[model samples]
Target chain A: MIEFKDVNFSVDNKIILENIDLTITTNEFVAIIGPNGAGKSTLIKILLNLIPNYTGQVFIEGKLNSEWLKTERIGYLPQKEEYDTKFPATVMDIALMGIAANKGVFARFNKQDKLKAMETLDKVGIKQFNNAQIGSLSGGEWQRLMLARALLTGSRYLILDEPEASIDKSGVNSFFDLLSELHKQGKTIITISHDLHMLNKYCTFLVCLNKTLHCHTETEMLTADHIKNTFGEALKLIEKDY
Target chain B: MLSYAFLIHALLGALLSGISLAILSPFVTLKKIAYMGEALSHIAFAGIALALLLSLNLSLVTMLFVLAVAGLIGFVSRFFQTEETNVITIFLSVAMALGIILISAKKDYSFDLASYLFGNVLLINKTDIYSLIVLSVVNISFITLLFKELFYMTYNMTVAEVFGIRVKTVYYLFLFLLAINIVVAVKIAGVILVTAQLVLPASIAFQYVRKLKPAIIISILVALVASLIGFYISWQFNLPTGAVIVLVEFMLYLLSLIINKRSKVRN
Candidate 1:
């Protein structure tokens, strides 16, 4: 569960998010949607406590976001950047980072951490690639690896930023299907995305955002008007048979 | 050679510097901060020149001076929100200019700039060895303790920050270790050629491996072999120790490149 109380974030005298207030309940799959520069990522960043300059408070399950982060209660997958393709890291090495907080800064990974990482990789369907170079993986495989890392934290709430942006169209359905499966297993998932169709089909709750909160309700309540209001234009929202 | 005290000290300094550089290299390469060595060494050169001019304890003065410069580099890069390479370039130019001015202004003590620029094993002493030991211990401890944190930072800074890892503090700590290593290495490789020790072995290891742990182990082995072979070659030919070691490492890197290419073609 999460709550944003009257949060206002600004930069250099320009308001990026203004008077934002929302609540996310437990075991709810939330998809935050907006256009470019619409403060979707900024909202996610605030939730992760990456930027602490906001005017209001963000509480995660009755605790402050900062405290939650300190306890490693939340897991995140940020938007992919142009990471070094030739970086000398194996799949296991990257996956082990999920347990870094639990192990602390000074301690080495114990047998349990390695086993959990391996199990999570198996859950993501890429356990066979555990020894493969991370740079050699396909986009879908890499995203799955990152998902494995997120799941490895043993956190109830998994927050992802644009997990589908880099994924191919054919891969998007399977990816959301995975998230749906995880949600059925009672994991609270909050994700930011530009893809409205996937958000409508897979996500239980939709929070339309645009520098300010526009709507937060069931996915069925997100109409074309909400889309126009949030994105400042009319865009096609594909209707899929559920 | 065994009877000479200076040779023994020089050998000890070389071994320690080689080990430290082997550890620092992979991080530097991964972080894309290789220019740090060049910038910090230039600043240390200025520190050395000032120490010679004032007839002070060269090691103490140089360490303090380079530490201050390292702090400034960290501060400027963080505070001004500028690219680290840009800040390093500015500091490099200023430090080199000041070193030249300081060395030229006081020409009485016969401060052989060439020996400092290249290196002279005979010049190493007990004080340099002591600094190397202390700095090496600190560096090893820092790397060992903060191994996971550093590895996470290298993989992705955002993930590290989100996990409450104190990315800034880790970065500053790394810069501190780097500054200390540069100071410890000066007695063995001199300012101009020292960064080769930090860069070449890691580069060679990266050419042959795709895993961080293996790459690190390979880097240390490469550095050890090069230092040992180069030490003997320099001793036999009466050549500069630092230059010979760097040359040997560079040649190994070239050989790795060829080996990698041939393997790729065969595959």
Candidate 2:
């Protein structure tokens, strides 16, 4: 389980996130929805312990975030633009990095690690590209590669930020299908996304956020008012889709 | 030339420094910080000037001074969230001006600045060889032990940090090692051409291979071969060693580009 108590984050005295109280239980497919500049990414950053100066307490599995981090790891897939695609690494080389944090400083990745990485790649349906250069991958294939890396961490909790931003519609569907499969296998997935229709389909819980926690409830219980409160002017467009 | 002790020392120095810098070249290129080698070498000039002015051990004072400035560069960029290139560029000019001012302040300081500007590999001594050996070992061990961490951080620092890899620590350590490498390499390549040695081999390797491990191996080979040929030509013709080596590397770079183009056309 993960819990955030009275979380608030600010930069240069301007509030980015304020009074964000939320909880994500085990095996919950949670989707955080908000407009652009609505502090959605900042919330994820806080949960990942990437933002250290936030005013609040974050607990992962009953331990403080810092303490939990020392003993545990979280699977994270950042925005695609955050990493260099032209890096001179093969697909296998990148997938193997998922286990780097767990190994000692001088330890090498053994055959078992290679086998596991390949298996994860296979699971994500990109095993054929195992030896391919990362720069050769398509946008959707790159997203799958990142998903494989995240899965290789073997963490029960996965956090993804804008995983579908660059992929085609079909790619997004398959990606969410994979996420749904992972959720079925007892992984707690917390994702920041813009696709409300997909969220309504797969997410078990929804957290509406726009610089603050507008609402937190089951996906089935989400209302038009909740969407309106979070994305005021954009509500009509979102409602059109619904 | 082979019988002369000084010539042999120069060869040994080239062998060690060539391999060491080649090992670090791919990271520098992949991170897009190729200018860092040039920046740090200029920073070392200030260190050299200060040491000359204070009548101190040149190598020790210069190493300390460069390391401190490198650390400061890392700190300022991280703390202020400024573009690293901006910080590096600012420090490069500041250090260059300071070096010239300090050298001018010492009216009787007859330390040959030309030797440092263009390098004199023929003047390499046993002490230089030993320092190069130490540098080679330190660089090799650091990369080997932390290869995974470095690879991950270079590819994606945010993801590396998210996964609990100490990206900040690795980044700072990388800067310090780069500073040390620049200071040591200054003797062979000089401040003017050091960045070429640090960047060219990797650029050549990248043109031929897409995989990093092969690229690194190719980079090492390119550096070693260039150093040997450059050393020989400079010894026979009495040309400056650093300039010759950089020229050989540049020629190799052009060759790689042509070969890569041909292969693409053939495909």
Candidate 3:
């Protein structure tokens, strides 16, 4: 479970998020939707303790985000653009980093860790590329590899940022299907995405955010007025379809 | 040359520094911080001047000074939200100017500028060789203990931090290690050659191998072989050791490029 109370964030005195209060119960498939520059990513960053200077409070699993970070792990899939693609790491090397993150600094990856990594890679449908260099992966394959890394964390909560941004149509479908399966398996998933149709299909709840909390409700209860209010009048077409 | 104690010390110095720098080479190449290495080497010039002026242990004083400068670079870049390269460049110029000014301040210092700039192999002694050994151990242990963390940070620092890797601590430690490396390596390889070694070995390795571990091994081998052969050639021909080693590394890099290209064409 995650909770944010009166969370407000700013940079250079420009308000990015204001008066945002939200709660994400366990096993909920939450989708945060907004237009560009809507502080969706920033909100996630604050929850992850990446942006520590934000106002108000953020709690993860009944503990402060900072305390939670010290004691627990959260699976995170950042935007693809954030990766250094030319880094000379094999797929297996990157997958093992997940285990490395959970272990002590000096602990070596044993046989069990390797097997677990392989299992996670298989689960993501990229086991064949385990020994392949990361630089050789396609966009969709890279997304799958990143998914494998996130899964290998073995965290109850998975936070993904724009997982479908660079993948093809078929890739996005399979990706969402995997998320749906994870959600069904009782993982609390909070994802930032632009694919409203997919979010409507898979997400249990919708949080409309544009510098503030415009709407927070179950997916089926989301109305066109809520979309318009959050995304402004420019997204009227999307609202009409909503 | 083999009979001379100074010559043997120089060879030992080359071998130890080669191994140490090779261990760090891949990280430097992958992170694209060869320029940081370059800037730090030049920054060590001011450190050297300060050491001489204060009548302190040159290596220790220079290492401490360079570490502080590296820390300052990290702090200023983060605080001002400026590009790190911009900060490094600013510090590089200021440090170089300060080096020259400090060296000029001494009326009878008689500093051997050329020896510091290009490195004098004959000046290497037992203490220098011992320092190189310590450097080699530190470099080896650092890479071995924190290899995964370093790899994660280099791959994507933000993602690493998101996963609770303490990226900032590791990054600052890396900077400190790099500062020490520059200060130590400068005694044998000098500024220009140290920068070249930091860049060339991993570059040559990547041309042959695609994975990080093999690339690191190949990088180490290339550095060792270059250092040994460069030492022998310089000893045989009475040439400058640092310049000769850089040339040899450059030649090997070109050879790797050729081999890689040929393999690609055949495929």
| TM-scores of chain B, in order | 0.93, 0.95, 0.95
Model 1, residue pairs in steric clash: none
lDDT of 3 by residue, A121-238 (tens): 9988999999888878998888888778878888998999989877888889999999899889989999998888899999999999999999989999999899888888657444
lDDT of 3 at A156: 92
Better of 1 and 3 by TM-score: 3
The list of candidate 2 runs beyond 4 A from truth reads: A236-242, B1-3, B75-84
| DockQ in order | 0.58, 0.68, 0.65
Rank by lDDT, descending? 2, 3, 1
Candidate 2 chain B minimal-lDDT segment of 10 residues: B115-124
- Candidate with better lDDT, 1 vs 3: 3
Q: Residue by residue across B1-267, what tens digits does model 1's lDDT show?
A: 555887788788787788788888888889888888888888988999999999999877988999988778779998988987888899988988998899998869686787777777778788878877887788778878888888877777877766566566788789878887887687678888988999998899999887677778898899889888899999999999999999999999999999999999999
Least accurate 10 contiguous residues by lDDT in model 3 chain A: A233-242
lDDT of 2 by residue, B1-267 (tens): 656877788888877778889999998998878798899899888998999999998889999988888879879999999998999899999999999999999999887898877777865788888888888889888888888878887887877877777776888788789888889888888888899999999999999887777888899999999999998998889899888988999999999999999999999
- Give the DockQ-based CAPRI class for model 1: medium
Query: How do all the candidates rank in terms of DockQ, highest first?
Result: 2, 3, 1
- Candidate 1 regions with alpha-carbon error over 4 angstroms: A234-242, B1-3
Query: What RMSD does model 3 have?
Result: 2.2
Per-model CA lDDT versus the true structure: 0.84, 0.87, 0.86
lDDT of 1 by residue, A54-124 (tens): 99999997988888777765778878755798887789888887777777668898888888899999988
